[model samples]
Target: MCSRIEDVITEKARTALLQVLGPLPWLEKAQGEVRPTDQIQLIRPYKGGHELALARWGFVSAGMGTAALKKYAMFNARGETLSESRAFGPAFRTQRCVVPLSAFYEWPTVDGKKRKTRMSRPDGLPLLVAGLWNRCEGSEGTVESCTLVTRPPTSDLLSVHDRMPALLLSKDLETWLHGTPEEAQTAALTSWRTGVLQMQAV
Candidate 1:
């Protein structure tokens, strides 16, 4: 499972997202590696187009105490069991989102030790990854959070990791965001092809 991701919401990425999903006038620009519990930008389905919202990287359910967050990890949700998972099933059905990235990092063993690897598209466009979001109301305030969806790794990246983030192509973004439950399930299960990314030791 991936616990870290590289920079997202760059200027280039924002442009790419706007080009495909149409104008998101309120989308803010940001850049940096993201980790669990970090606040990040999420593209959500809204008003027949897309809208930009801010959400913490990890999924937080209603009434889930702070201490519980430390006990469980909800940053990445497995695609295969999404429908069966209490933490992910509801969001998977109605709260699908896109997590855009300039690149993502993975640690793979090289020689005698594990080395950091950066994986990105050859054309330098943003990679739109599938995700599920939720809103939890607590005493402090309302917290919105999200979790990335992952599937079995492609052959090209199997040596790097056993699972990879589920990516959404431009054509399928709508289906993922607003399709019926069944159609959305199909979109979630579709993994991007291999060779679309180039990995480098970093």
Candidate 2:
């Protein structure tokens, strides 16, 4: 599981987003290593195009009480079960978004010692990870949160980790952001099957 990642919305990453997605709205900063529950930059579908928004890292289930929900970690949702999960199913069909990352960290056992590895694309582009978001109202008020989508690692990454974040390619961005549910699913599956990222020991 991808439990930790580099700061998602670095200036460099913002520049990359601008180049691809074009003139994203300026969002407040939440710098440093990002963990679950932190406010992070998310590029979600907006009135036909995309917009930058800040959302908490974990997906909050509206049906579950606060006590029960606290025990469950909803930071990463399994791609295989997207359509079946109560917290993710509805979000997957409509509230999909992209989690941009400068890099993600993985802890892999190498020999007798576990090593920290940094995962990123070979071409130095930002990693646009597919994700789902939801809005839940509670006694405190309303909260918007998101969860990264994960799938079985590709052949090359199996040795490094069992699962990796589902990524979106440049071509599939439009389909994923605005296409029908079926088309979005197809785009997601294609991304999981074909996306490539490189890992390096930090």
Candidate 3:
């Protein structure tokens, strides 16, 4: 499950990124320590165009109180059940999005102890992970949130964890954002090649 991430790009880097990934919405700095419920940068297809928005990174159940949310973790949705989960099904079909991050954190059991691990693109480029988003109304307000879609692990990633976030590489991003849900699901199942995704103990 992708629960924490790093977005260590500088402001200048973010500006350059915006040009390539923009028509972004107004948002504050998101260049480090991203966690569940934090405002995260996401891009979604809308009205024949792409717009970047500051989206919360966890799915909030409708009408759940704030206190309940504090103890809930809906940051990762399993891709195998994308069409089956009540909370994520509709969003997966219609509100698909991509999450941008430099790297994501994981905890893997090694030598009988769990250790912090970091997974990133070997090329140092930012990654766009597949996701589903929703806007739910509650007593507090209308909360817009998202969840990463995870797939069964690639052989390379299996050493770190049994699952990895469904990533949309440059070659597949456009189709994933614009294709039908069935197409997107098929695309997401194509796992990353060995040596493309780097993992290290942190």
Better of 2 and 3 by lDDT: 2
Ranking by lDDT: 1, 2, 3
Q: Which stretches of candidate 3 lie over 4 Å from their true place?
A: 10-31, 67-72
Q: Count the backbone clashes (under 3 Å) in each candidate.
A: 0, 0, 0
The estimated TM-scores of all candidates read 0.93, 0.89, 0.86
Best by TM-score: 1
How far out, in Å, is residue 116 in model 2? Answer: 1.2
For residues 1-202, could you state the per-residue lDDT of candidate 1 as single tens digits? 8788865556766678778887775455455677888887778988877888889899998779989888889999998888898889889888999988777889999897999998889787988889999998987889999999998888899899998988878888888888886787678677477779999888
**lDDT per model vs. reference:** 0.84, 0.80, 0.77
User: All predictions: root-mean-square deviation over Cα?
Assistant: 1.6, 2.1, 2.6
Off by over 4 Å in 2: 8-12, 28-30, 192-196
Tens-digit lDDT track for model 2 on 19-114? Answer: 878888766555757888888778886776678888889888785567866898899998888888776889988899988887888889999789
Better lDDT candidate (1, 2): 1
When sorted by TM-score, best at the front, the candidate numbers are: 1, 2, 3
Clashing residue pairs for model 2: none
Clashing pairs in 1: none
1-202: candidate 3 lDDT, tens digit per residue? 7788876654654664566566565355656668887788777887777877667888876776878778878899888788888878888878888877788889999999999988887766776788888888877677888888888887877778788888776677766677787788877777345668788888
Better of 1 and 3 by TM-score: 1
